[model samples]
Target chain A: MKFSIQKDRFAQSVQDVLKAISSRTTIPILTGIKIDVTEEGIKLTGSDSDISIESFIPQEEEGKILAEIEQPGSIVLNARFFNEIVKKLPLDRIEIEVMNSFQTVIRSGQSEFNLNGLDPEEYPHLPQIEEREVFKMPTDLLKTIIRQTVFAVSASETRPILTGVNWRMEDGRLVCIATDSHRLAMRKAAVETDSDAEYNVVIPGKSLNELSKILDDTKEPVEIVITDSQVLFRAKHLLFYSRLLEGNYPDTSRLIPTESKTKLELNTKEFLQAIDRASLLAREERNNVVKLSVIDQDTIEISSNSPEIGKVTEQVKSRSVEGDELRISFSAKYMMDALKALDGTEINVQFTGAMKPFIIRPEQDDSTLQLILPVRTY
Target chain B: MKFSIQKDRFAQSVQDVLKAISSRTTIPILTGIKIDVTEEGIKLTGSDSDISIESFIPQEEEGKILAEIEQPGSIVLNARFFNEIVKKLPLDRIEIEVMNSFQTVIRSGQSEFNLNGLDPEEYPHLPQIEEREVFKMPTDLLKTIIRQTVFAVSASETRPILTGVNWRMEDGRLVCIATDSHRLAMRKAAVETDSDAEYNVVIPGKSLNELSKILDDTKEPVEIVITDSQVLFRAKHLLFYSRLLEGNYPDTSRLIPTESKTKLELNTKEFLQAIDRASLLAREERNNVVKLSVIDQDTIEISSNSPEIGKVTEQVKSRSVEGDELRISFSAKYMMDALKALDGTEINVQFTGAMKPFIIRPEQDDSTLQLILPVRTY
Candidate 1:
């Protein structure tokens, strides 16, 4: 294989694929990145068996020549060393050539690096899925959905199903939900699809987090194809694949409280700041709990106490507070996360009682909701 | 103690003192910060036995009022909690008052915190040094001198003395040197001192690092006083004290080689970049060794090799190479650090032999010098 390419564009593509490569993979060859050169262009593939990422570089882009190919072949090189060398090459253009016995030489201005390459034939093939029903959504909207719900997923491995976000798409409407039993986040949006097929798949939260980083904040449409065991997200020049978790997600619709004995409307920024300050003391406790007391329509007081350290109390003014007065305690971290994800200046909070689950929503927005189960305090 | 102070200034002072306080101290009281209130102003102090820092806020500075003292008293509060609370107070002005049983109340806009305070009497007293003769230097210059020499100190405690920088003062000139037995960095400067007391002392590298962080970049003069066991650095509103290491520093004047077998002049940046690229492959070796081979009166080639991994070679043009051709190997990290510390555009390198130590100096400057030993590579 012999090719010369523009240095900056090639470096970016190399880094994007490297995010999926893992040093601790069970298969040793999976730790390397495979480069395939064809008559059309060059494709770079990286995989750790669970997640695979592929990025392509066209021979010419926008009437500008990016690469000149002398031969068509394939080679696999160490992902770590390849990235480090590519980024530090002294010139704007670099050349790579493969010799006998898979010895690869990379040359830039006056610098050269020779790396031991692996046989590409030993690499595993990426899963190929027939595009039966590909759905599309704006790149920015997909990133928002991923950020809103992924943080609520369970980090523990005991209940592996809860470690992923459940996606259900039907009738052009898609709903995504993630819950760790104590707290839950749900977001709903509309997608563009031509087929009538529906998808109810669970995507690992780790995969969504990495996907969010790769997606840009543009209105470009991303086509998603889902199968029984594999899912693919296709962007302009990149392809991301993730394995589906094989388990039934728990039903969370019944867990959200429908009735409210106490209702309040407050500024999200004010509430979040109060909770952050109160948590400073609460952080000394094992549960990291803070208490909130509503004094009718007068004020809302947030407080935390530690036996040895001390206590803190702060009062925040709210837009309105109705129904019976109440006091409740919950994890400060959970409340802050809910407020931040809601991303609204004004939020409406509803509580059935101190012990039951509470739901929070952005004012006048019914498509997003957050639920938290308050902790019992004596 | 009762006082209302400007929140921003108070918060900055708290952070500065907290740098000296450690949570894992052997003495329990050392974990708390002592606040002393007097008729003039308020003083905040933190100490970890080896180092102590104190910041004072006068009642008024210039024509602006910074604090309002209601009474004169003293108390010690947990350094960690004090800093966190002060930084997040809701108002621009915060009031701190001590009530019965040493219970301190901190109040801002509508927020209040009650903290358990310790008796100031139990806190260890700071070392007091009588100033017989004090030396003055530009604050910015002192910071620069500290940065140039501190990184060369030994991180290992095997030879405890090597972990500190030796400061020798005589005839109004001060010289500092640091080495870890492999590489050495030396810096010298002139100070304004009237006393003829020739002095030599070793200051802990950790102390200088912390002191550098607390100082700001300015041309204002800083007063430094050294005694038998302690050194004090006094600024406008801050006082920093550090304990001196007790040992005799070995004489190193004879270790420098005067005769040279090869000499080369090169651009500091170009040579540094070449070595950085070569180090990418050399980093896999146990010693991180990179080789430099000079072609007489021609370009210099830098290279590194690993048996398992490949190799790299880069050629950098030098201004003049008047010495005999030679090939030598040394640690790339030491060379990079020395180059960065020199901060010069053009540098002159002198090599005595393949086995002897070599010295690097900024062109036409004699106040700063770096020396490194070559490693034997078969």
Candidate 2:
């Protein structure tokens, strides 16, 4: 392929595709980024078997000639070294041309780089799925759905299915849930989709995180296509595909508490600060457990103790409390994560008992909820 | 000990002393910070054997009560955890009191921390240095002196003295030199010092780097005290002590050439950028060598070629070049370091021959110089 493209446009497209580049050298061809030039634009593709990212750079943008194609062909180049050279090239525009043997030549300003390129036929092809089960959602909503639940997924590979976030659609509402068995996060939103379509899929949390990073924060709509095993998200000039995790996701509906005996409404900021200070001491302990004690009708105490290090106690006032005097211990990290996922100024936490799991939800909205199992502290 | 101190003041002092705390558990006592309180104020000290730092919180400052000592005593606390606790505490003023048997209670706002403290008598005492051989220099100058030469020190400990920066005082001028055998950096400055007492001492590059970080970017003077085996720097309420490296440093005077066969002057920024681009291709090679060829009086070519990674060629313009057509190869990293150390916009590079070492200095002033040995490339 012979082409000349502007440096910045090419750099951005390369970066988008590089998100899927395989860092492992076990599969030699997978470590390369495949480039194809056509009359319309240049397409860049990178895949690591689990996820694939494809970005296209158009020929013209804002009356500037971004790329001029002489011949349409394909070649795969090393992703890392190619990206570094393109970033450091000291010119506004770059010229790239490939020889008959797939030797690539990149020229900018007074600097020129010639690299050995591999045949595009050696690279793995991306599976193409028919766009029958497709839906549209706002980019911001999709990113939020991914961020709120991805962190709760089990990072350990013991239960491969638990390492993925479960997504289910019913009655035009999309629900995303993830749990590592210790804590759980759930978010629900109304995505624009056909009423007849009902879908359930589990995508690896690590892939979702990478996809979220590549998603731009814009008001544009993102089109998602789901197959039997692969899901694709297309936004602007970028296409992201992730493989679905196998096996059934455990029923999380029964994990959330339906009722509580004690409830407290507190300002999220004040509660977060109190927990942060209490966590300072708890983090020194092995289990990172902090206790919460509710007293009278207006005061809540957060405390943590480590026998070898120290103990810290903090008092935080609540907006309203209608609960029996109680003391409960739970993972400080879990409480901090649940608080961060919430966006409301005031949050309501419901407690069943010292041993039973507790629920945290926004005071004004119940669409999002977090549940944490309290640790038994003797 | 009992005292109340402003949170900001206490936090700053704690941070300063925490720098000396060792993260390694090899020296258990070095992991803790020693605290001493008297009628005057409170002193915090942290030592890791190689370096010691002490920061004092005065009884009053700017007509405001920074600290009030109710009783005089001493104790030691774990530095890392204590610094984190103090930084996260939610109060403008904090009160700390020592209970029976070294238990310390730290209270601020509605939060309280009860930390286990160690008896201060077990902490190592800092060696007292006589102030007879002393001098003073602005903190900024001292920091600059350290930065310009520290990078050239040999990181390998094969030759102990090569890992340190050689500092010498002669004829009221302080000269600092660091060489890793491949490259050398020398900087000299006139400072007010004891003319009768000419001194030579080698300090470890790591210690100088830490000292430079602790010095503020103000014009305040820092007192320097030199002893038989240690050096002390006092600035404001902070005291920094570093152990001197023992051993005879190699004589580097004969390594620098006094005469040159060719000279070239170019803009430092442009030359550095050209070398940076050229190095991108050479980075994959074993030695990362970039070659410079002076073809004429106005233009110079910088190039690097790797058998597997291709070649890069960049042409840089020069203000003046009166050299014989010469081609020399050297490490891109060493050249970049020399360019970064140049204090002037234009730099003059003097080349003695193809294989001899070259000198790089500012065109206006030559007090500071950098030398790089050319690689023998067949």
Candidate 3:
């Protein structure tokens, strides 16, 4: 491959693809990034079996020439070193040339680099998924959905299916859910699709985490194509593919309590801060558990006690409190994560009892809900 | 003990002292910070055997009450948890009360914490250093000197004395030197001493690093007292004491050459960037070696070749070049460190020969100099 391209453009593309390249890959070739030059543009691909990322730089962008092709060829370079060199190159334009035996030379300004390139033919081929069920949504909305639910996914691999976020589409509405048995998060949004056929898939939480980082905050649309075993997210000049988990996701709709004997509405920031301070002492203990007890109609006490370290109690004013008095204990980390994901100034928390799971939702909307199972404390 | 202090002032004092409290210490009481409430003010001390730091919060400053002492007493609280609690407390004023059996209750606004405190009598006493020979220098200057020389200290424990920075004073001038045998950094400054006595001491590099972080960038003078076993630094409201390394420091004066066969003056930033880029490829090799050769009277080439990965060559322009043409190879990391230590826009590099150590000094002054030994490349 012989082509000259703008250094900044190439560096950005290389960085985007690098997210999928892991250093500990079992397949040696997976550690390398494949670079293919065609008549239209140049494509870079990086994969780690679980996820594959491809970024393309067109020959011309906005009437300005970004790259000029001298010959069409392909080669694989060590992703780690290649990305480092590209980022540190001290020039605007970089020229890359491939010689016999796949010896690649990169030149920019007065600096030049010659790297040993592997045969691109040994690289794994991108899985082909027929575009039968493709849906489009604003990039901002997709990013928000991923952020709101992905953190609640089970980090433990005991239940492999729970390590992914389950996505279900029905009647043009899409719902995403993630739960670790002790805590659950769900978000619902509307998407545009040509077919009314319903579908369900579980995408590894790690894939969603990486995808969210690469997604920009622009209002542009992103096309998602789902198949039985793979999924693809397509944006401008970028293609992200992730393998689908091969198990049925557990039904979580029945886990959230529909009615509660006690309800409280409080300022999100104030409640989060109180829990955060209480966690300072609770974190030293085994379970990182914090307790909340209703003091009066308008006040609640958040506290945690460690036998050896210390005990902390914080009183936060609630906007409104109703129903019976109650005290409950739960993981401070789970509560903080749930509060952070909710949008708005106020949050409504519902409790069925001290021992049962409770639900938390933004006071302004009901499209998202977080449920946490309370810990039994003597 | 009972006192109400401004939260921000108390938090800053706690943070400053906590740096000396290490969790791995064998002395159990050393993990706690000693808090002594006196009629005049409150003092907080934290120690880990090798170093001790104390910060004082005066009762009143400029007619403003920073703290009000209700009674006089002392106790020790766990440094790790106390610092975290103080930082996250949600109030402007904090009240700390030591109850029966050293149970400390800290109250701020609607929040309260009761922590287990250790007996103040069990905490190790701070070493007393007689004010026999005290010197004064600008805090900013002291911080700069430490930063410019401390990084060259040997990290390997093979020669324990090399892990410290040697401080020597003679004829009203103070010199600090640090070397790992392969590279050396030296900085000199003038200070006012109470007597014309010469002294030398080696302070651990880790202690200096922590002390430098707490020093403010002000023109106010800092008093330093040196003794046979320990050195003490006194600032406005802070006292830092560090134990001296007990060994003789090697003389490094003979290592620097008096004359050079080749002399080059170049912009410090440009030359550093070129070396940084060259190191990108060289770092993959075993030794991280980069070669520099004089191409002409006013230009030089910086390059690195990794037989398995690639080769990179960069040509950087020089302001002036004199003496014989030479090519030398050295550790890119050492060269980068030496270049970063220089303080001016331009730097003067002097090389005795291809195989001898080179000296790099700021073009504007001789207050600081860095010496790097070249690697013998085959």
Return the top candidate by DockQ.
Answer: 3
**Residue pairs clashing, model 2:** none
Model 2 regions lying over 4 Å from their true place: A62-64
TM-score of candidate 3 chain B vs. the reference: 0.99
Top-lDDT candidate index: 3
| Regions more than 4 Å wrong, model 3 | none
lDDT of 2: 0.89
Candidate 3 lDDT, A335-357, residue by residue in tens: 99999999988999999999999
**Residue pairs of candidate 3 with colliding backbone atoms:** none
Per-residue lDDT of candidate 3, residues B163-207 (tens digit) = 999999989999999999999999999998869989899999999
Model 3 / residue A176 / CA error / Å: 0.4
**Candidate 1 chain B weakest ten by summed lDDT:** B279-288
* Tens digits of per-residue lDDT for model 1, B1-378: 799999999999999999899999989899899999887898999999999999999999999999999999999999998899999888899999999988999999988999999988999889989968999999999999999999999999988999999999978899999999999999999999988878899999999999999999999999999999999999989999999999987787877788788999999998998899889887875468999999758588999998677999999998988777889999999999999999689999999888889999999998998999899987
Best of the two (1, 2) by lDDT: 1
lDDT of 2 by residue, B1-378 (tens): 888888888898889888777798597778898999998899999999889999988898778778878888888988888898889888888988989888999999999999999888899999788758778889998888888899999999989899999989888788899999999999998877754578899988988988888889988998888877998999999999999999888999999999988899999999999898888878866478999999788999999988776777888899989857789999999999989977889999999998999999998886899999999998
Pick out the ten consecutive residues of candidate 2 chain A with the lowest summed lDDT: A279-288
Return the TM-score for each candidate structure.
0.99, 0.97, 0.98
Model 2 reproduces a share of the real contacts of 0.81
Better of 1 and 3 by TM-score: 1
